[model samples]
Target chain A: MKAIILFGHGARDARWREPFDRLAQLWQEQHPSTPVQLAFLELMQPSLEEAVTTLAAKGATDLTIVPVFFGQGGHLRNDFPVLLEECRGKFPNMTLSATPAVGEDLAVLQAIVDFGARAL
Target chain B: MKAIILFGHGARDARWREPFDRLAQLWQEQHPSTPVQLAFLELMQPSLEEAVTTLAAKGATDLTIVPVFFGQGGHLRNDFPVLLEECRGKFPNMTLSATPAVGEDLAVLQAIVDFGARAL
Candidate 1:
């Protein structure tokens, strides 16, 4: 089975995870077949490794990690790859892949533009 | 006149601002009448004050700042208000307002969900 992990740059404030929780909920609701988990880079629970372990134990053979950040900074370019490599080494049985930060998506950018337009 | 500023948490990598630049471009293209500018919270050029000043100079009497961040953590709840207050003090004549972070928008979140679904 396939699973998804919505990864984010976690913040100190607990409230910061609200949208992330909402994202996971939406994913589970819409894609019931594909299990979803939330993982954070730092300062939040369920690091990438933990999330991957959970999914792998749940019978997820293939997993896609989506970076929910708006920018592909050092975290994405540097830190994330190392983390993924570690996960890959630990879980050689699972097929793991990642997509670019959500901000790179045209539709996501368009949604932000639309949000700004509506606010104006 | 009215203008918009796309506010973001800047990163050390200059390339991280690509989406922000695209956002400003899309705004200019779609809303030709409303001038747009990009501002960073830190580690980037053109802080909020600079963007506001530029817009004010461009005959913008009303300005709307859209936080491109995904979460309203301490940065938004604590730091952002203080910065906004300073900007307000400097440009009292210009009406400055802000919308919630783009992440809070249902449409933006939906776009992210769709992006993840497509990647799976």
Candidate 2:
């Protein structure tokens, strides 16, 4: 089975995870076959490693991590790679891969522009 | 006149602003009459006040600020209001309003979900 993780830079505010929760729910609703999980980088529950373990336990052989951030900053460039490497080391049998930050997607940016246009 | 400002949380890495730059370019290209500016909360150039000033000088009497953040955490809920208030004080004649974070938009969230689906 294949699973996906929406990784975010967690914040001190509990409500900060609301969108991530919504993203996971949306993914699950649209892609029922692909199990979805929400993972945080820090200051939140279910770190990337924990999320991977949960999916691994559920027989997920391949996993994709999508960084739910607006920038490829130090967290994505530095912290994330180390964590991913650790996950790879721990889950040697599973195939793990990642995509560029969702912000890098043109459609995502266009959506934001549309939202601003509507607001104006 | 009316204008828009795409506000984002700045990062230490300069390359982090590439998406934001693209967003401004897209807005300018699509809505040339409205005019667009980029602002950052911290660690980047062109603060919100500066953006407001730029638009004000451009003869913009009404301005809309769109928070380009994923979650309404302390930054959006707490810090942003303070900054907006300061801008209002500095530019008292300009009519300024702000929308909820772009992440709060259903279309934006759907776009992210679609991006993940395509990657999978």
TM-score of each: 0.99, 0.99
Best by lDDT: 1
Per-residue CA lDDT of candidate 2, range B18-99, in tens?
Answer: 9999999999999999999999999998999999988999999999999999999999999999999999999889899999
**Residue pairs in steric clash, candidate 2?**
none
Predicted model 2 interface RMSD: 0.6
Second chain alone, TM-score for each candidate: 0.98, 0.98
Residue A67 displacement in candidate 1 (angstroms): 0.5
Among all windows of ten consecutive residues in candidate 1 chain B, which has the lowest summed lDDT? B14-23
Give interface RMSD for all predictions: 0.6, 0.6
Q: How well is each residue in B1-120 modelled by candidate 1, as lDDT tens digits? A: 989999999999987999999999999999999999999999998999999989998999989999998888999999999999999999989999999999899899999999999998
True interface contacts retained by model 1: 0.78
